[model samples]
Target: MKILIVSYYPLGFGGAEVSMKILASGLKKLGHEIIFASTGHYEGYKNYKLRNYRKIPFFFLRDNLLGNELIKIINKERIDIIHSNGYYTSLAVLKAAKKTGIKSVVHFRDYALACVKSTCLDSSNKEHERDTYRHIFVEYFPLRWIWEFYKWSYIKRSWKKIKQFDLVISNSNPVKEKLKSLGIESTYLANPVDLEERTKTSVKELRKEYKIKEFTILYAGTLEEHKGIYELLVTLKDFLIKNKVRFIIAGKGSSYFKILKYILENTIINAKMIGMKQHEEIMRLYKLSDLIVVPSIWKEPLPRTILEAMQNNKPVLATNVGGNIDLIKDEYNGYLIKNNEWEQRIKELMKNKSLREKLGRNGRKLLEEKHDLKKISKELEGMYKKILIKN
Candidate 1:
């Protein structure tokens, strides 16, 4: 089958982009021809071509033009299906697929379909117990009703477009359930990782390269408020000073400058920021970590970091929310606790090498049994074929 994969960017370093690339390769290996229709370019995918969308003041005109262009590509390429990965590219792809009478698939990797805040967190960076209209209105003020109405309008419009697709996939059960609540039925499929490839880095060499002389805890994600960067810093500031440990923070965002300023002003000597590192470099860092911390204040669909850490045979300490609870069984594969209890958890793990090793081993076992990429790829292949036959 000739498939056109639509995405916001052709090449990106994010988890969704990486997962799509891996999926494309697996499909290609299965003898399917893949063509990319995106706004950006990457050298590895030879069939990549830019399809720029229109900006504000000309949104509908741009979408119409893009949809027509996609229709042209579908006819010219004899495309059998269109697979879109992000919200920005879904409308044009689905419209084109409908026009050409070809099947279309859409993947929901995040909470954008139902929540305007995306993280599903309130102004205080706490997950709302009830995500109802009243709760949303009361959380954000000034013109709460206007914003609330706008979110409803946006989600309703999005759902109308999304319903056009033949198949919709969600990366986690929580996201799938969230979509179901909005009257959108979706297939649940968890994200997968290449276990062997992810742990290829030489641990000894990495330790030497990074000058790792102390027990290290790694945090690799967007350095933002929603990600609990500020909360993490505050919780670990005094603990880091009193203990023989190192905290390595990676990735940059709006909170990067604020974190840097705090670190400098407070003289958090044991903590260090490496900004952003490529996937391979991140894997190497994961290899050196005694434990990985995912301090997200929001409900993450599923973070690739947790899987990667587990695959590398490292115990994960994550907040008790979203997919974190799904992966970590307290005192089993990993620890799931509140953000405030992080200091105590870290100290306990640091003081007990046997406990750390046991948790790490269990985490790897969980990764192989459930989150391996090969198994997930086959499941996806089946889903695609099923959709094709059904249509």
Candidate 2:
């Protein structure tokens, strides 16, 4: 099968980009010829390095010239299936695929369509402003605004074109539910992780590298307001100061500097903000972490950070929202704290070392059973084959 994987950015970073890389590589490994069509080039994944794969620039956003050129590639390559990740790129690919009469599959990785605000929140970070002009004013705004304002418009547009494809795929149940509410059918697929790269870092080495003397709590992912970084900081500051534990925050975001200043001036907790380390370094942080926290205030689809932490044998403490409940069996593998119970839960995990270790072991077992990349890749392969056969 000749497959074309469409994505907006390069595959060096970001959850969606990494997912495309994994899925494309996995399909290629299963004897399918894969080509990555993107707006820009990814840093690490050179075209010559991949098997039965090529990365082509479509430049769909740059005046639609690339979209027409991509149509030419689609016909020339004799592409059988077109898989698109995220919203903007999916819209473009769906358009091109419609013209080429190729099978198109749009994979939903976030809540881009369901929420009007699109962050799954009513407003941006600082204001906590709900139902503001930004939320209500929906006309002639920038591309970002248009995407969020008329998400349903694009969604309906894609749906019209999607009839050419065999299926629509979503990474989480919440996303699938959203699609269903829109009267669009979609298949549920788990996001893939490179388990081999994740498992390469040893716990001991990770601890030593991070200088983790005490029970270190780790948080990775964007330090945005919707991610509940501020709330986590407030909760962890009091708990960690009392328990003498350390906290390390990884990843970059709009609120990174502000959060850093808040920690410096307001809290005495031993905290450090290591902004956006490499992927390998992030895996090491996961190994060193005694517990990982995904304290998203809003409903998240499925966080790759939580999956990576679990795969690294680190217990997770996430907010009881979105697809988190599906991944975490509270008290069995990890703690699913309610919005109000966050501080109490952190304190409880801090006090009980045995409980933490038990949960960590259980999480590792769960990862092997359900969230491992090898298992997920097989599921994706089956989906690809089914779609191909149907087409």
Query: Which candidate number would show the highest lDDT if scored against the true structure?
Result: 1
Q: How does each model score on lDDT? A: 0.80, 0.71
Query: Candidate 2 on 1-391: residue-level lDDT in tens?
Result: 7887767666445777777777666666677787777655644332322111123322234315445656776887888877777765565566677788877788887765554445546544422212333544542246565444454454445555554456688898988887777667889988776556654656787677667788788888887788898777876666666767788888888889889888878775688888887666777788777889888877788888888877776778888888788789999888898756767776777788899888878877877777667777788878777766663
Output the TM-score of candidate 2: 0.84
Off by over 4 Å in 1: 10-13, 51-54, 57-59, 128-152
Query: How many residue pairs clash in each candidate at the backbone level?
Result: 0, 0
TM-score of each: 0.91, 0.84
After superposition, the stretches of candidate 2 with alpha carbons farther than 4 Å from their true spots are: 40-63, 124-135, 138-159, 162-164, 198-201, 267-269
The most accurate candidate by TM-score is 1
Residues 300-391 of candidate 1: C-alpha lDDT, one tens digit per residue: 88888888888788999998888788888889978887647888899899999899999999998998888777787778888888888983
